[model samples]
Target: MSEFGRENPQFYLTAPTACPYLPGKYERKVFTHLVGEKASALNDILTQGGFRRSQNIAYRPACEACKACVSVRVRVDEFQPSRTFRRIIKRNADLIGEELPPQPSADQYALFRDYLDMRHAEGGMAEMTVLDYAMMVEDTHVETRVIEYRRRGPDSGIRGRGRGPLIAVALTDVLSDGLSMVYSFFDPDMADRSLGTFMILDHIERARKAGLPYVYLGYWVKGSPKMGYKIRFAPQEHLTGTGWLRVEGEDDAQD
Candidate 1:
């Protein structure tokens, strides 16, 4: 029996599929639905145990003969922005993040499509339709928020929200201890702004202000270039056999 309640959540295993990060490796996942009244509690527990929530499902890597995928979370209070990170913050100083309910919009889908087409044309979600994207955003039982980043406008102070077109978007979950970044995408054309790093930095600040201790950053795969950026956030903890082991210093990966 699991710790959640008298009846344990039923788990399902996914068939082996080509690993998106590492070549010559296959990946499998053990997943369970995140539903019912206890969903938020279950989400918090599972995430602390290294499970990542997608839509209404919470999943973890259960690949056979491999253990490269590691869960990571940033220590919000202790994290100080590096010189490069500082520049990224200053670079996007005009931008503001507005947290909205988990609702989808055509504008968001357009930006999402552009991001996928440019950054991940060959990725698994490349073919996701607008309706599919809606499900991805709205299909959740836990406390979820869709944060849209855009440029600050003239009346920004009064409105408390950004104006103009959306520049980036992040799907986040509010956990008892931290914020989990389920998914995020930005305008590929604004790559110079380093929006990805900016979003993480923003989340850390947001979590800190919310009195959260950590910012769950999903997984960081060893030797995978796509996941290398995750190691840049210092004072982060990696989920290991002995539980979350804290790591210091930042990896110098290309910005």
Candidate 2:
């Protein structure tokens, strides 16, 4: 079993399946349950070692012949937004994000369905019903939250919360080192706002305020157009075989 502590959590490996990110290739994962009193501490350790938490399970890529899925985390303290990133933030300045308990809502599910239908229509999560979406948000053992973004209202300045329809949602985990973005979805109609990038920028600021140094952005696969946007956040670290290494250049060829 993988080393964590004396508890010795049982580990398992999944059968090979077609990789969604890289076509014509298959992938596998090694995972273990994150339950019991020490779940939060164990999650922090596993996450730092490149494992991502999905519900109560912590998993990492275990492909035998391929290692394209490299874990990435933004160095929040060192991050300086580029001109393009600043523009995206400015465009989204009218919205406010509020961290809420891991509670499911009808509005969240509706936005999730729209996002899947537009962005990932043929993906695995496209067929998920409202119940599945609820489980995805509420079924967690570690410290997790749902950050909802909405249009700012007149009382937002005093209440620190937005009003009106929910435009975006981020299902995030609060690790000791930083925030781990498990999943995020935005209103497809707001494509011009670049909500995806804006959410990441907001998370960076949140981490900074919390005195956290990193913002884990999950796996970044080489040659995948969908994941290429992740590299735009400079001075980020990619988990290599040797350890976490700092990458600053905007070259996708290095991966």
Candidate 3:
């Protein structure tokens, strides 16, 4: 029996596969299902232990010989944006992000599809159907929200939401200690806006506004070019064998 009044979570190791982040390396994962009444609580615990949630599953790197996937979380209250990050925010000023319930829509799927085609056509999620996209958003038992970014309309300030076509979307989870960015995608045409980085900056601000201490940014591989952007946020903490340790670097200036 386990703490949730059932058998203990049965963990499984995934078969080794080509590492997505590094060339000539393989990767594996330890995963378990997040289900039932205790799913939310279990998710929080697993996440704190460095696991990332995808739909109804929580998984973490269990690679045989590689430890490149280090978990990272931004110190929301202590974060200071770089000049480059500030520029990204300024460039996206016309967009507004509205946090809505985890309900999928045709419009969102369209944007998701376009993003996949343009950015991740060779990735795993590129083949996902509309149904799969909806399941990703609505399958969770934990507290989750979808933040949709769009162009601000005339009534935006009054309603606190934007109108026009959806340009980006972020699937997030509200953990007891932080906000976990489950997944996010944007219109590839708007790459110049740096919407990806802007979304993270916004999430940090959102976490600060909600009195959260951290904003989980999932894994950051040290040598992976694709993951280098995560390190730009200052005063972040990286999970280590001992515990979560604050990373000190050139970007440590206080805001």
TM-scores for all candidates? Answer: 0.96, 0.95, 0.94
Worst 10 residues of 2 by lDDT: 246-255
Per-residue lDDT tens digits for candidate 2, residues 1-255, read 234532678879999999999999999999988877788999999999999998889999999999999999999999998878888899999999999999999999999999999999999998999898888888888999899999999999888899999999999999999999999999999899989999999999999999999999999888898888888788899999899999983733321
| Alpha-carbon shift of residue 246 in model 1 (angstroms) | 0.5
The per-model lDDT (C-alpha) reads 0.94, 0.91, 0.90
Best by lDDT: 1
lDDT of 3 by residue, 191-216 (tens): 88989989999999999999999999
lDDT (10s digit) by residue, model 1, range 170-219: 99999999999999999999999999999999999999999999999999
The TM-score of predicted model 1 comes to 0.96
Query: Looking at candidate 3, what is the lDDT of residue 138?
Result: 97
Query: Which is better, 1 or 2, measured by TM-score?
Result: 1
Give the distance in Å from residue 146's predicted Cα in candidate 3 to where it truly belongs. 0.5
**Candidate 2 TM-score to native:** 0.95
Per-residue error at 9 for model 2, in Å? 1.0
Better of 2 and 3 by lDDT: 2
Candidate 2: clashing residue pairs, number: 0
